[model samples]
Structures are given as structure tokens and as C-alpha cells.
Target chain A: MERTYVITGAASGIGKATKELLEARGARVIGADIAGSDVNVDLTTLQGRQTLVSEVERLSDGRIDAVLAVAGLSSPTVATAAVNYFGAVATLEGLRPLLAKSDSPRAVAVTSMASLMPHDDALLDAFLDGNEEAALARAAELAAGSPEQGNLIYGSSKQALSRWVRRQAPTADWAGANIPVNAVAPGVVLTPMTASLTGTEEARTQLAGMVPMPLNGFFGPESVAQLLAWLSSEENGHLCGQVIFIDGGSDAVIRGDSTW
Target chain B: MERTYVITGAASGIGKATKELLEARGARVIGADIAGSDVNVDLTTLQGRQTLVSEVERLSDGRIDAVLAVAGLSSPTVATAAVNYFGAVATLEGLRPLLAKSDSPRAVAVTSMASLMPHDDALLDAFLDGNEEAALARAAELAAGSPEQGNLIYGSSKQALSRWVRRQAPTADWAGANIPVNAVAPGVVLTPMTASLTGTEEARTQLAGMVPMPLNGFFGPESVAQLLAWLSSEENGHLCGQVIFIDGGSDAVIRGDSTW
Candidate 1:
């Protein structure tokens, strides 16, 4: 059977790599992005979510084997909260019915190592509470403050999204229906999203001090894509709710046995 | 001043190993368990939780450096739910005040690789909702059923505990007060707890079939002990809400990239 997949943020970066990998292996992927994809729709809005559901359903003939909610923002704005947390959640929830028709339905999303960073408690709470309006308002309030405050918007969005994935995986809609829903927490990848931040040696060092990946300093989109492809595969069945870190032992080196 | 530590389940297994390792390094340890330890309190009860807090405070003179909540049960009984989830939580939460007295405070607990297995949704919800009576009742109901049904109690307890550890890691008390709290999920370990299950070659093979640790196969309490000691160390500052798996390559092999 030609497995059908719907991938958000398929225009570039990790999403692009994942789309390429799955397509190369003879899978049918319906790419969705703000621009240059089969379904061009902004995922940060309610109308965008509705459009995505109808379009993906129409394109795939009302069936999808998996969903990869890879689209996200790394900026320090309310827009980051809108796209990263709210947008990703809406993408998964809205498209879940289309995915339910498959025997081996899987879902995976992208979160960041920044999830571990200190964040704004109110904004994180609002996202978890499912109040998009309040979440964006909180993000806006933080944005008008210092740079560290701005960073919290990005950090909290990623953190809340990761927590959401973990909590939702075993819920009735996903795990109860035998669909394995999970998320990937990448340390720092060399993609269009983070090129300028890690382009120079000085920038890389500074980022490394914060990220501190011991295995390989900075990897490309392909490594994360490889992992993402495997997650969305039918073979992966055991992992119910996990945020696997793919940063060359950065998790081991920095976190140590703290998590264990 | 020497660091003072409180370790539950110090009578045997991973806690005993961790206690020995930490003490050998010149730290002072106040061991606790059901029997054969400094404070022999049954942590499955509220009175036991209160006893542990008061006694540990007396032993350490109202001050402690770290808390290792290693007491747990793997049986298919309500006692397992009481001890594994509620007990470990009380061990840390009860001793947290004493830990805050130290210049370097840390907390860690032990979860299991079985946490990834299919679980009872109602029981899991009960545990998460902080309803001990309900959780135990649900566990008792499942324990009277088939072997697989009985297994869900242990799995759900561990799973719930792991989630609780993650959620609490960033909250007002632990992370807010600068106490680095985390958990470690181990695969099968050759200890008093699992000696009968993984004793013979046949039994080990059966266990391996379920666990699927591709790296070094089954591990020992010493390996987990080393990690627990590090998590309690002052050096671990970056990690929050992480459950590091010390299960050879079981997590990696089985889960693949589902979480990444």
C-alpha cells in the first residue's frame, strides 16, 4: 500500500528533509506550508486549520496513514506562540480524523531543546489551558520587556507544546485509538531556521555553551529528518509519550543522570 | 560541612547501591525503608510519610542535601500503586523542606522501562489527579483480572510517576526554590526485586523479548546507582522535568525515533 502522509511546514528545514526522505522511499506526502506547498495555508489561525482539514481530506481521499506537524517558529514574538504551540496543536487535532482511517496511524511533532530553558509561567499555563487568545496576550506582554523576556516566549511555546504532546499521547483520541503520538526535542540543528545563529565559529561556540551537545556539535536537517521518518513509520509501536532528544548526547552530557 | 542525604528504599536494590556509593564518597546518608534501615517507615501510608519527614528532619538536624525516593513495588497489587506513585512522591515532597536548607539541594526518583507499556486509563488518571484512594481502588480492580491486566497497575504507576516528576520539575517549589528534581527509568535490573523473573536463561530471554535492550542487555543496580548519585550532585543544574532511561539501549531500540 502507498502510505499517505500529511506534513506541515513542508516548505523548508526539517519538514522539507522529512518530506524528501518519505517521498524517496515511495510514500505519498501531501505537503502543507504558508507558501510553496500543495496546501498553502497559515496554521496559526482557526480558518487556516479548517482549510487544512478540508484540503488534506480532499487531496488524500479522506485517508492519511500519518501526520508530521513539523512547522514551527523560533522567533521571540507572540507569533512564535501562535505558530509553535497553538498552530501545531490545531494541526494535529484538526487532521486527526483523516489519520484515523489508517491501520498504522502515527503522529510526530517538532519541539526544541529550548523547551528546557526557563520560561514564562503564565504563557505556558495559558497554552496548556487551551486559551489561544490568553496565550498570545501573555506572549505580547512578555515581548515588550527585555531580551530574556522575549526569549521566554519562544521557550515557553516549545516547552508547552512538548508537555502537550506527552500528555495527549496516551489520551483517548491518540493512544486509545492505537495511534502512537509523540514529539522530537532537537538540541540545535543547522537549518534555514537557525543558520545565521550558527554560521560563524563564534556564534557556534556561544550556542554550544548553552546547548552543549557532546556527541556532534551541530548537525543538519537530515539527521533529525531520519529520526522523524522512523517515528512516523508503522514499525514504531512501543513509544507512547516521549520527547526523544537527538543532539549527539547533548542530553546525556548536560542533563546527566538528573532525569534518571 | 559534609553533605547529608536522605534515601528511601535503602534496604536493598538500587537505593542500597546508591547509598553505598554516596557514603563511600564521604557523604553522610540517612537510609529509610520498610525494614533494615535508619527510618523503617512504610511509605505506602500517610502516617509513614509523616514519620519519614519528622524522623529525617531529626536525623539531619532540620537540614539535608538531597533526597533519593527509590522506594517502590512492582507487584500487581494496590500496594504497588500506593508505594510506587504516591510513596515516591511523598518521599520527595515530604523531605523537600530539609533539602532546601542545603546550599546544594537535589531530588531524584526511580521509574521503570515498563512505563511505556499499555496502561489502564482510569488508573492512570486517578494517579495523576492525586486521588490515592481512587488509584488504589482501580489498581485492586485490575489486580483481580488476567496477568496482562495486573501488569497495567505497575506500568501505569511508573508512567504516572514519571509524568508527575516531569510536571513538578518546573513548578513553584522544586525549580522555583532551586532544587533540581528529576527521575531515572531503568530496564530490568538483576536485584532482589527481579531475581525470580530474570534468574534463569529462559526467564532472562522472556524478559528480554519484552524489554528488547539491544545495547548491553540487562543491567545491574550499580549502573543506575552511579546515575542517581550524579543527579543528586550539585553540578546538575540544567535538567528539569526529564526522565533519563538507564536501560542499556532498550529505549533506543524499541522506541526508535518516535520521541525525537
Candidate 2:
């Protein structure tokens, strides 16, 4: 029997590409997305994520091999966090039980290139403490007042989640559990999001200029999709809690110069 | 005239040690902390940080050389971000004007060993964005009325800040502004914070076992203070945004592990 995989956000873009790639390669795939026919679960809510896990469990018939969580929103900041940050967390938490049944389960989630921003101490501590209620309160407070703060809140939420992956990685006992986890960070990708940025000339110019290495312009969805597929494969067992940057060598161009 | 310097969190621990070390070398040290009189300001609040900047400006008397933000908190996570994270940003922003006035001004901040935690693309982007208000909001949302997320917030915050520093260091234009910035990550020190950790049997056992190398237990404050002083000197111009780890070879030991 071929190994099976489950991918979220399979309705479009990278997620769709992943589904086609895996299925074409003979791996059984259970595509989960808000728009998919078989698994139309809105993963932004806990219940929706739980349902996704249940569907994957049933599809795998007691042997879901891996989960590739590409489900996310690509809006300004708040929308991004609602789906990408908390949504990913809910999906992971809900899927843990089913994944545990696999002989060599792995997971890879999607995050953005924008999370490179800076934050001071108080804000960082609140996120790291992982206090659910307080984090929500803080987010609401910041959102109640301004857009700039809300944007930072979105990025910081992702930042906290990333660090949580790293800190917990050392103690995960993944080897014993036969599970591995990792993340991927992609730079500018020409998706519907990129089209939206072009709505304003300033936004388009600024976004385009941010990339140091000209990959003829920017990466497309297919570029990121390939990387995600590999990360979700059994061939990637050794890597865990790492956010590999696939920015067409843009990050490398700043050798000795780039801070991150 | 003796070269003048400012040290916050100077009442005890690393701050106090740095102050004494600098003063011993004939440097004029202006100590500050909520617990002391030279300057009393809470770094967590914008207003408090402004007061710190104002008082430091007054005390400089047109002879300020460098600012060392060693002030930090040791609470589980939230408090750590409040002091170590926000305090650092507030102080730095507040001191920029004064630093620009100096002939060859430089600044250094302290981070923790816990910053090695992993991060995702979204979080990394958020951190690199550097919008403080947004950071606070996202932090609030993540904490979500709970306190647990705050425990791990420090590592996340530091990672984001460190990444930002790295990003900023390459082209900060601080030299043109007559100021430079740098940071250091230290391991457990023989301070009140470490002492408290020692008080807890579980923490002590866990930390003791976690020390990767044959460490000489916790490092003395002077060891780190010396590093801070050197980094702050006008001589270290090219070292901006560099986060040097001073853990008595623990980081190196981990690097050599066969696990990787």
C-alpha cells in the first residue's frame, strides 16, 4: 500500500499543487480545505479543525502518514493571524491523536516571510508564556485601537508560534513518538495576494524592491509548493522545528550583511 | 574628563556588575533603575521609558558616550518580555537622539540563552516588521486571557528582536547618525535570578543537567559585563546588531552534537 498524506488549504495555490504532486507520485492524499468538496472545514475554529482531524483519521483507515498544514489566510495582518497562526495551532493540536497512530508521522506548517519584524520585551513575554486568554485580550486591546499595532500583533503571533516550535522541539520526544515537525518560510510569491499588492503602485514597488535577488521578479505558488511537498515526505525525517527559507537565494545575497 | 556611560537595572545582578566594572576602569557610570535614584523608570511603559530617556539626557551633561541596557526581568515569561524586550526597545528609541549627538556613540543590550528556540515564517516576519503596537496586540491575542503563553514569550521576543537586529545591522546607517547598536546572549549567571532558579528542586535539577558542557556552574557577572563594555566601546564599530553568545562554550558543545 502506498503511503498516505493529508494537506490543508488544498482548494487553491500551493495546497492544490501539493495535492496534485503527491497524488501523481502514487501517495494517497486527503485534501482538506474550506472550499474542498470532501473536506470543506473552516479551520479557523477549533471545531472545524477537530472535524478535519476526524476526516483524515477516517480516510487514512488507521494510518495517516503525515500532515501538511498549508491552510491560511493572506490578508493584511489580523486576517493572516486568524487563519495562519491560530488556525495552524488548532489543526496541529487536533491532529496529534491521529498522527500518533502512524509509524512515522510528520508535520510541516506554512508561515510567511513577513515575520522578520522586531518586537520589544513585554510583548514577546506574553506570547511566549502561551497564556491563551491573556494573548487574546492583548490582541483585542491592540486591535480596538490601531491598525499598525494589529499588524505587529499578527506577525508577533506567528513569531511566538515559531519559537514555541523551537523550544518544545528539544523536549518533544518525537523520536520516541515517531513524529517530526518542521516549518517553511517563503519570500515574495506571486499569488492572488501579490495581485492585491499591485492595486497600489506604491505597495507594488515597495514589495518588489524588498527582494534583494531578482528571481526574474518573485517566486510563484509552484515554487513554494515543491518545498512543502518534500518537507511532508518521509524522506525529511531528520529535520524538525526549522523554517527553511526558499526565497530564490535572496537571503543568501546579504551574506554577512543580513541580520536574520 | 572620564568617558561617561549609562547602565540600567544597575541595582543588582548583571547591571550592577557592569556598572562597577565600568566605573573601576575610570568610566563615569550613571546607574538607573526603579529601585535606585540615579534614574527611576519602568521600561515596560512608554511613559516610563520616556522618563528614563529624559533623565539620562539631563545627566549626560553633554558628555555621554554609550548606553548599556542591561535592565531585564526574570519572571517565568511575561515579565521577562516586559523588561528584557520592551524596556530595551523603549530605551534604545529614547536614547537615539542623545546617541546621535555623540562623536562615536555605541549601545548594547542583553538577551538570554533561551533565544535558541525555533520560529516559523509568519512569526519571523512579524518580528522583522518592528511595529511595536502591532506586536503588543498580537501578543494580547496569543495570551488570550491566560498567563501560560507568557512563560515562553521571552524566547520568542528575543528571537524576533535578535533577527531584527541582524536585519538592521547590515544597513542601520547608525554610523552616519553617530550611533551603533549590538546585543549579547548570556547563559545562566550567579545572580538573584539564577539563585531563585536554584531554589526550585525541579528547575535546579533540570538546568544543571541541561548545561551542555563541563561548565564552571553559573558564570560570574563580571565575565558578561566585560563583554558588554567591549561591545559598547567606540572601537567595535563593525559589530552592530551582532548577538554574541557568552555561555562558557555550551553553545559550541551543542553545535558539535552528533544529533544534528
Candidate 3:
């Protein structure tokens, strides 16, 4: 039987890469995105999330084998936290019932190496505390302040999303239901989302300084897609709530053994 | 001249212990708390935080040497995130200018072993995103759900707070002003806060299971206070933005070279 999967941000970047790879591998892929996808739904609002969940349930007939929340934003903006943290979470939680109907359900979310960067305490607090409206408003306010502030929102959103995956993995809705939930923290990947940075020599140099990729140079979307596919596969049963960093050793270089 | 220091939550627990130790070392200590203190201030509200900051500035005549954000909440409550993350941050950030007046200014906050526990993504995001109202409301909602939920809030608040300190340490207001900022993450300290857990055999066993303190049994408040004092003293110059886990090998046991 072909595995049925729902992938968000499926119109571009790593999400699109994953969708292509999964489809080529004989999986039935339902691609959701803001535009130019099978399902057109904005992930930044509660209504948008509800629309996505209902659409997935209808498309899959109330059964889903895997869910890949790959849609995300890199630049700082008011919508960054809403999209990265809440958007990803809504996909998983809202589709959880459908995943439960499957014999082997698996889920994965996209975090980023940015999670290791400095974060604003207030932003983190609002998201964790479940105040989406306030969090979004604050994120927008920060975005208006400066690009650096936006970067902070981006990093904190990824960090919080990864933490959420870890926390929820042990709960009844996930690991308890035999649905292994995990996240992938990737380094700089050559995608449309990062074209602005990779295209500019100075920006690339500055990025390299901030995150020294001890492995090869920057990664292709396919490199990260491969890892995401495996984690979301039925073969992956034991691993739960892990944020596997496929960042070409960026996390290793920055954090070192301090967190170990 | 003896250095003057302001310590919040000084009426009890780690704050009280830190105050006693600092005073014994011939430093002038200003204790702040809800009651029976040199300064009566609640750290859970913005107004409370503002009052504490203004009082300290007035008392020090705007020439204080150090600030210790030791006031914190362990149990799960809506106030946990507010007091633990925002309150501590407000203390340090609000009083930053005054500390700059000293020849060698230092600041230390009390985080906990709880930081290692599973945390809610929403709560962590809200706090880190700087959305205080939403974060507090979400925390209260979670507290209404269960104690375990409360535990998650407590742990995440500490984790976010520590991250905040790390993020701000390298900035102009701190290291640039010659003030070192750091946090102490202690494990299983024998304080009034842990009386219920340490007092019960079952709770002790459960705690041991969650965090194996291989180095020693439960520690006294003074043990943690000693570390805080050193971190806050002029003797500490080069170290900044470190959440040193003085947890008797709990962090070592749990994370174990993975983050190294």
C-alpha cells in the first residue's frame, strides 16, 4: 500500500523537495501551502490552520500515515513566530486524529540552526504560554524595529518549535499513540528562502562566521529532505521527540559539548 | 568601600540563603520580597518590577555594585513564567545602568534543574517572543489543567530565562559595560521550595529517577548560594553568559557529552 502523507510548505524549498522525493518513492503526497499547491491555506492564522486540518482530513478520508510540517520562514517578520511555531504545531495536533487511525503514524517538523542563536525572552514566553495573538503582535512590533529583531524572532520560533516537539512526543497523543514525533534542525540550505543570503558574497561570509559548517559547504534542500523522509518513515519506530540536527555540524561547532 | 547589592526573593529559599552568605562576607545586602524584607516588592507584575527597580536605584543613589535576580517560582502557576523569566530579566535589565557605575559589576540569576525537563512550545515561544500578557495567560490556563503542566511551565521559564541571559551578555549594556551576566542552574537543592519532595520517600525516589544526582544527595540552599555569590562577585571577570549547572552531575548524567 502506498503511504499517504501531508506536507506543508510543499510549494517550495525543503518541503517541496520532500514532496517530490516522497511522490517518486510511490507515496501519495498531499501538498499544502499558501499558494501554488494542492491545498491553498495560510498557516499563520487560527482559521487558516483549521482550514488546513479540515482539508487534510477530507483529502485523506480521515487517515494519514505521516505528516511533515516543513513550511517555515527564515527572515524576521511578525508572521515568523505564527508560521514557524504555531503553524507547524497546528499541522501536527490538528491532524493527530487522522494519524492515530494509521497502523504506523509518524510526524516531523522543520526547525533551524537559528535556534541556537540569542532569543528575546518576552517572545519565547508569549509563545510557550499559548498567547498566539500577543506573540504575533509582538513579533510584528519587533520586525518593525529592525532586521536583527526579526532574526531573534526567527531563532526563538525555531527553538520553541523544536522544544514543543520534544515535549509533546512523550504525551498520549504522540508517542503514546505510537506516533513518533521529531524535528530537523538544518543549517544554511540553498533554497529560494535563503537566496538573498547565499546570492550575496558578503552575506554568505557573515553567515559562515556566525555558523561555521565544519562539514561540506552549504546544503541542498535534498540533503535535508533525505533526513526528513527517514524520520517520517514507518521504519523509524523507536526514536521520539529528538531534534536531529542535519546542519553539517553547525550545531556541533557552535554549542560544542556544553549542552552534552 | 563595601559593595551594595540588591537581592530579590530574599525573604526565603535561595534568595535568603544568598543574602545571608553575601552579608557574612562583609557586603551590604538589600533584601526584597513580598514581606519581612528591606524592600517589599512583588516580582510578578510589570508595576511590581518597576517599583523594585526604582527602589533599588533610589537606595543605591544610582551607584550600586551588583544585582542578583534570585526571586523565582518553582511550582506551576500563571505567575511562574512572569516571575521567573520577566521578573528576573526586568531586575537585571531595569537596573543595568546603575550597575555600570561600579568598577566591576556582576549579575546572576537563579535558574533550576527543571530547565532540562520537557517544555511546551507555545509557552517557551510566548516568553522568548516577548509577549508577556499572552504568556502569563497561557501559563495560568496550563496550571488549571494539571501539576505536570505546571512543571513544564516552570522548567521552560527557567530554560528561556537562561537563554535570555546568554543572549544579552555580549551586548553593550552588559559585557560592554564591564558587567558580567550569568545564571546558576542547580539540581535538587534542599530549600523550602523542595521540602515536599525531599521530605517524602516516594517523591525522593521519583526525583532520583528523573535526575540522578550522582555527585551528592540533596544540597542545602547555601550550596547553591555559594555559587551565586562567586558569580556575582568582582572576582569573576572573564566569564559571561554561562548557565553553569551546579546540580551534582544531574546535567552530566542526563545530557552526557551530547551537547559538548
Maximum-DockQ candidate: 1
Taking the candidates in order, what DockQ does each have? 0.04, 0.03, 0.02
lDDT of 1 by residue, B1-260 (tens): 78888999999999999899999999999999999999999988999999999999888899999999999988898899999999999988888888889888889989998888889999999998999999989998999989989989998999899888866765667767877677888888878999989879999888988986543456678878877876687545444556866664466556653342
> What digit string (tens of lDDT, one per residue) describes model 3 on residues A1-260?
78999999999999999999999999999999999998899999888999999988899999999999998987788777889999999999999999999988889999988888998888988887778988888898888887788779988898888778766765566655778777778888899999998898999999899876544558689877776777787655544565666564466556642342
**lDDT per residue as tens, model 1, A179-210:** 77778788788899998889899998898888
Chain A TM-scores of each predicted structure, in the order given, are 0.98, 0.85, 0.98
The residue-by-residue lDDT of candidate 2 on A1-260, one tens digit each, is 57778888888877887788888889888888887546888875667877887787777786777888777765444445456666777777667677787766777777655555543244445667755555656666666656667656656655665665444433334433646566665666766655776567788687666544232345567757666766576544444445544453334334433332
Q: Tell me the spans in candidate 3 whose CA falls farther than 4 Å from its real position.
A: B1-260
Give lDDT: candidate 1, residue B248. 47
**Residue B106 of model 1, lDDT score:** 86
TM-score of chain A of 2: 0.85
Q: Residue B196 of candidate 1: its Cα lDDT? A: 89
Clash count, one per candidate: 6, 68, 38
Q: Lowest-scoring 10 consecutive residues by lDDT in candidate 1 chain A? A: A251-260
TM-score of chain B of each: 0.98, 0.85, 0.97
Candidate 2 residue-wise lDDT, B1-260, digit = tens: 56778888898889999899888889988888877748887777778888888888888865577888888875544345566667776777677777766776777788765666543333334545765555556555545545545445656677766554554443434433545566777767778867876777798777866654232345568777877776676544433345655553344344422111
Better of 2 and 3 by TM-score: 3
The TM-score, computed over Cα atoms with residue i paired to residue i, of candidate 1 is 0.56
Q: Which lDDT value does model 2 have at B180? A: 55
